[model samples]
Structures are given as structure tokens and as C-alpha cells.
Target: MPAASITIIFSPYHVGLRNHRVGDGPNRIRALGLIPQLEALGVTVHIDEIPPVDDFEGEIGRSFEVLRRTSLAVSKARDGNSFPFILSGNCMASVGAACGLGIKDLNFIYFDAHDDMDTPSTNENGYFDAMGLSMLAGKSWHWHTEQIPGYAPMNYKDRFLYVGLRDVNETQRKTVAEAGADVIWGDAGKAVDFPGELEKRLDKRDMSPSLVHLDLDVLDKSVGMVNGFESEGGLQEEDVMRCMSLLPKKATPVSFTMCSFNPNLGDGDKIAGIGIRAAVAFVEALIATSVVSVQQ
Candidate 1:
């Protein structure tokens, strides 16, 4: 464990949207199960929890606090010449990871069913948390991204790959199109690469350094998505796991953060748990490959 890479579980529940499900449990609580499972991966996880902050303004305020703590913790750890971090968080928690994992720049592989590019201005809800990806992409955000100092101008071309888009508002679709983003849409796109296509996608990014964020609802409701909007044409656990196995190791240190998982979705929890377990398997594959390649 001393030499194994660290998996920082940055769980900021303040902006935590309890995933409402029928005959099921809450997402945040269900997420508790992920901790022990992740520990089995031979990585240390830092589960950072902030109370529950509901709206945009409140979420933004507390996020700053969480970000500061995460930064301090990471800085005190080591020279950080180690592998890129494996992070997990709620909503805007990814933003904190984006800010904290500022090692030689990082490309964000944002996997969600929704485009999440709506700005405060374009948002029908006028909410900020819903518009996190927009802020992270340096598009436009409520105040969460705009007001945050020392972390904007967020890398675009050299960073950011989008996957599993199904229910996107026109604005977010437009944002992705205009951003020259490399997106994997529908099953066709998801099926494009095995281990090779994903490798190229991540490595192709000018910066190469990157991280992966998985929004659990990216799966179809049939599969039992607890929280977040689920869309049709989402990837099955096998396909998603296959893609994960293909990611380029030399590109950057990686972390897999999944959100919007509602425990209450009766079966959704099973589906959510399986999706995450599949992901853990993918990481195990990476570890095996890393070890095997070294021994050879």
C-alpha cells in the first residue's frame, strides 16, 4: 500500500443532490458502499464530505472551502511525481478536482448522459450546479466557475473529451459542437474503439494529461439509474468497461469519479454498483498491465 497510487475520494455532499428513487435508497448514502469496494483497489481514498448545499450560490461558496482543503492535502502529500490521481466526487466536485489536479495540465473525459453545458444565462432552471461542465470548459457558468480565481481559462483543445451524450439541451449540444470537442455519441460512437480508440482520444489531446469523470445516470433507466437524468442509447457496463480498459497510460494520471447515483432506485443501486464495480475491474486491468509491461 505504501507504494500503490492514491485514490482520493473527494465526496463533497453539500451540493449533494439526494438521488430520489422509487422503492430504493438515496444516492449519497448508497455511495457509502463504494468506499470499501474502492479500498480493495489498493489505492488510498480521501472521502471529503461537505454538508448538503442545495442551490447554485450555496454550492459555489462551500466548494471553494473544499477546494482549498483538497489542495492543501495534496500539496502536503509528496512531490506528486506519482501517477495522476483517481478522484470521485458529487457534482461540482469535479471542478475542485480540476483545480486541484493541476499537474502539467489535465484533459477531462466527462462521461454523462447530459451535455451539462448550459450556462446560467442559457439555463431554463437558472441553476449553477447544472452548468458545471460549461464552467469547467471555460464556457460560461453562474458564479461557481467565473468567480473562482487562479483556475479558469480552462484548457479546451489539449483537454476535454465527451462521451455518452443522449439528453442534451440545444445550448449544450451547440457548445459541444462549437468547442471542437471530440464526442462519442450513441452506441456507434461508444463502439468505435476497443482499447485503441480511447487511447488515441486521450493521447491525441495536445496536453495528454487527463482524468475521467463518470456521471452514473449515463446508463439507461432500464439499467436502473438512481439519480440524474438517464438517457437511452447509453453504454452498457461491458461496453463502458471495455472503453475504460483502452485508455492510454502514458497520457496522464487518471481517476474515475462517478456521480448522480441514487441508492433509492431499488434496482438502480444494483445497476449503479455494477457499473462502478466494472470500473474497478477496469482499473485492476490497468494495474495488471502496468505490472506485466514492467516485468517483461
Candidate 2:
């Protein structure tokens, strides 16, 4: 592993509320020893917190503010040639992280339980988080999304990889299909080769920096529930660790993020520990990949 440094940008806000519900997950996971574990490997790790806003805006206003702050932090980290690691309450932070890394020609690898593809008109539940992937694909929320610093709607084409989908609605399924994304369903009855699928897609494209985003709810309930939205048939812990190790082999991951963890829920500490371990695994994979690159 080459000598490297990382900047961890954590947002302890869920839907713009500080330490509310899932917002606590980031701090909790960090407290669980994510930083010390990385430092043990002799990796330099810097910590940055998203500044809490004084004005009381609604969820929509606050959420975008969080994203804007996140983008700035991410850009600063990348400017220093440090890897950006985001720990946020909402998976939508991926937009800010990607934009900060410069969105032009950037590829995305998404791991989530839900499709997160509902548009404003299509989302009956009125859940803002559900529309994250849709916004990334430039399918919805044009006005608000444009407000986010460094944010531009993502170009899906062949550069998008959606994995561990098991609880998507019909509308989300249709939306994802129309985008022509490569998907690996979590509920497939047959065995899955996570690395093989990732490599196959990566082989089709020129090597470019990628953002790897993991929503903790992608883990199965049996592994310990990560949030209220967790369902029965999601990926197991071993499956997630294996995928984390293999993703860096083909994709040059410039940034990594884990979101959608609600520590207020049952067994929060257990899930936080799992998330911390996965994060450590990802950094180790990055180190190993970098060493191999240097060797060649």
C-alpha cells in the first residue's frame, strides 16, 4: 500500500435536523473506532464536520445546505490529493461528493436496498430520500438540485451500476430500467459473483475515478437492522465485505460514502460496528489496489 491520506466529512444531520434519528449514525459509527482503525494501518486520516446552520429552514432548504457544505469539504479534500470519505444520514450526499470530485465522466457504484428512483410526481409517499438516485440520473427536482454547489444532474448511460436492490416499487423499477443501468439484484436465488459483475461493466469503459456509495440498509435484517426501512432479503455481511474488496480492483474509487443508518433504532451499536468494519475494509482495499498499481 502506498502512503496515502483520507478526509472524512461527516454530516450529523438527517433531513437537516442535527442529531435527529439517522443523523446520529455518523458520530456513533466514528465513535465506534473507524478513525483509530485506519490510523493503525499508518494511514493519515483527517476529520471534518458539516457546520450546523443557525437559520431554521424546512427540510428541503436544510437538506440542500447540508449538501452544499458537503461539496465544499469534499472539494478541499480532493484538492489536497486526499481520498474523500463521507458519512452522512442521507444517501443523497453522493451527489455533493460526486460533484466535488468533478462530475464530468465520473462513474457511480450504488449499493442500496431500495431503488431510490422515484420522481417528485411519482413518489406517493413524499419521501425526499427516495428520490436521490432519480435526481442523480437527472430525472427530477431540477430547481432545487441546481441550487446545490457543484451539482449537475448525472449522466447514467453505461456508467451507472446499481447493486443489492430488493425492495423497489414498480415505478422505481421502471425508472431504473429506462435509465439502462446495470443491476445485480440482492434477492437472486442463484449465487452472485459481485466482483465479476463489477469487472465486466468496468471493462466496457475507460478507466475513470468512481464514487462508491453504500446505504447501510442494504444489509439484511438477519445481519442486524440498520434502519427502519430495512427489509428481509438484503445482502449478508460477508457479501458486503467481499464486494467492498473487489470494487477497487477495477474501479478507481476516489470517494466512498455510507449513509441511511439510523442509530436510534434497535441494535444501533451493532449496526454501527458493522458499518465501521466495512469502511475499514474499503480503505484497506484501496491501499492494496494502489500497491498493485505501483508494482506494475
Candidate 3:
């Protein structure tokens, strides 16, 4: 059974700027009636937004502030027994959500076109979001992560699984291999048994309720560019939903976070609609397969 209520936390900042670039995605998705749709699924909905940084902190400072705020909001929602759902412009917010879940040892099912395991030393572009997974895995950025409340890096090697990884650099590829993380490559142009693939690697006994992070760029460019980082040979909308639906069998999805969407890209409304459908599908699937109910 689903929680009696769900809290949606919106962090609408892209690289620290409010409503800028992909930062606009969170509000855009909400504007598309995501709340009503989720409520129609029979759960009370509470809304929360991460406030913008009052000062002109550098991207690093502002971004960490956003994560800190997200951590607190998600933590509050969890304390109230509400399932927390997050929408953010950058994938880094997953770390905040995980920390807020109050689980020191956690598993993650990540969907993205890129590996997101780059370190400052390895990332030539200096893209901070690229280091999200590395930070969560305790590989880089130790200085800042320690400041966030309730954060402890995990031995996330086998605990993490990657789906739709087709666009990546050699550094990212090497990191994935060295970490021994399981992956499902996207460019393999054939019908994939997503559940069968996941089941083969995931040991249910070792799993608990886990977080599901969706970087919209995991969708194929043919599905309309979800963001500037979208690549070819990605999954279709149905493929994403199918994969999400299977998660409950292996590990119940206690929380879901959708990130890295840029409404400025091709056909913003169309792309947001896909995200809306995905959110609804994820919630509905959770409801269908829910084995425990937490009343608020």
C-alpha cells in the first residue's frame, strides 16, 4: 500500500541559478499538472520548494546549498511518514535525497545517458553534476559532502545499477569498471528483458527500499531532446516505465527523484508531458506492488 501522503520537493536551480537553464524544468513539470495527476492516484500531496540562494555564491556554493535544503525538506517528509518525491534540475540532488532517507547503507537504481562518475581531476569540462555518483560513492568531494546533515558515503559498488549508459568518456567508463557497478548499455539495439537483466544481478535478500533516480536525458533524442545532454540510442518513454515497474519486485522504490530536464530544449511541453507520464506511472506501479503501508 502507498503512503497516505506524498511530499514533492522542487529544487529549481541549475548550477545554482534559479529558473535558469535546466533549473526551469522543475516548475515547468509542476505547471503541467503533476500534482493533480498524482493526487488522482489517491494520495494527499504536499508541496515544498527549495529557496534560491540569497547571495551570489559561486556555482559550487549555491549548488551545495540547494542540496542542503533538499536534504532537510526530504528528511522532514520522511519523518512525517510521507513518501518523498523530488524534482530537480541537476542529478546531484539524488545524494541529498539519499542522505535524507536516513539510511546509511542504501541501494540506487539510476537511469541516465552518462555515467555521472567523474571527478574534478578527471572531468575536462569541469561539470559538477558529472561527479554526483562519485560523491555518493565516497570517491570525490569529501570536503563538501561532510557538511550536509546525515550524509555518510557508502560502499556503493555493487549497490548501484546503471541503465541507459551510452554517452560517456573514458574516465567515466574506467570508473564504472573499477567500481564494479553493473550496467545496461543503451546502444545495444535489440529488445531487452529489463526485469530479467535486473533480476540476474540484484539479490533481493541484500536489497531494501531503494531510491530511483531518473535523468530525463536517458530518453532517446528521437523522443525529443529532454536536455542538452540527450544522446541517440536511448530508451523510449515506454521502456522507462517498464523498467520502473519492475523495481518493486526486486526492491520497493521508497522514493523517486527526476532530474536533469531542460525545458528550453526541443518542444518543452511535449518533453514535460513525457516526464509527467513517467511520474504517474512510477507512483501507480508503487501503489500496485506496495507490500507495506505507512499511514500518516
Against the reference, the lDDT scores of all candidates come to 0.55, 0.80, 0.81
Ranking by TM-score: 3, 2, 1
Q: What are the per-residue Cα lDDT tens digits for candidate 2 across 1-296?
A: 34258889988888888888888889889888889987776678889899886475799888888888888999998777778899998888887897788768888888888878888889887778888777766788778778777877777777778777778777778878888777877764555555566667677775457888999988877788687887766777887887888788777888899999888778889988889888878888888887222112
Clashing pairs in 3: none
Candidate maximizing TM-score: 3
Best by lDDT: 3
Q: How would you encode candidate 3's per-residue C-alpha lDDT over 197-288 as one tens digit per residue? A: 66765653455668889899988888886778778778888888777667776687777899888898767888898899888877777777
What lDDT does candidate 1 reach at residue 143?
53
TM-score of 1: 0.75
User: Which residue ranges in model 1 land beyond 4 Å of their true spot?
Assistant: 1-3, 12-33, 41-60, 63-89, 141-150, 187-207, 248-250, 289-296
The total number of steric clashes, by the backbone 3 Å criterion, in model 1 comes to 12
Segments in model 2 whose C-alpha atoms lie over 4 Å from true places: 1-3, 54-56, 188-196, 199-207, 291-296
List ranges where model 3 is wrong by over 4 Å.
Answer: 188-196, 199-206, 291-296
Model 2 scores a TM of 0.92
Q: Model 2, 114: alpha-carbon shift in Å?
A: 1.4
- Greater lDDT among 1 and 2 belongs to 2
Worst 10 residues of 2 by lDDT: 287-296
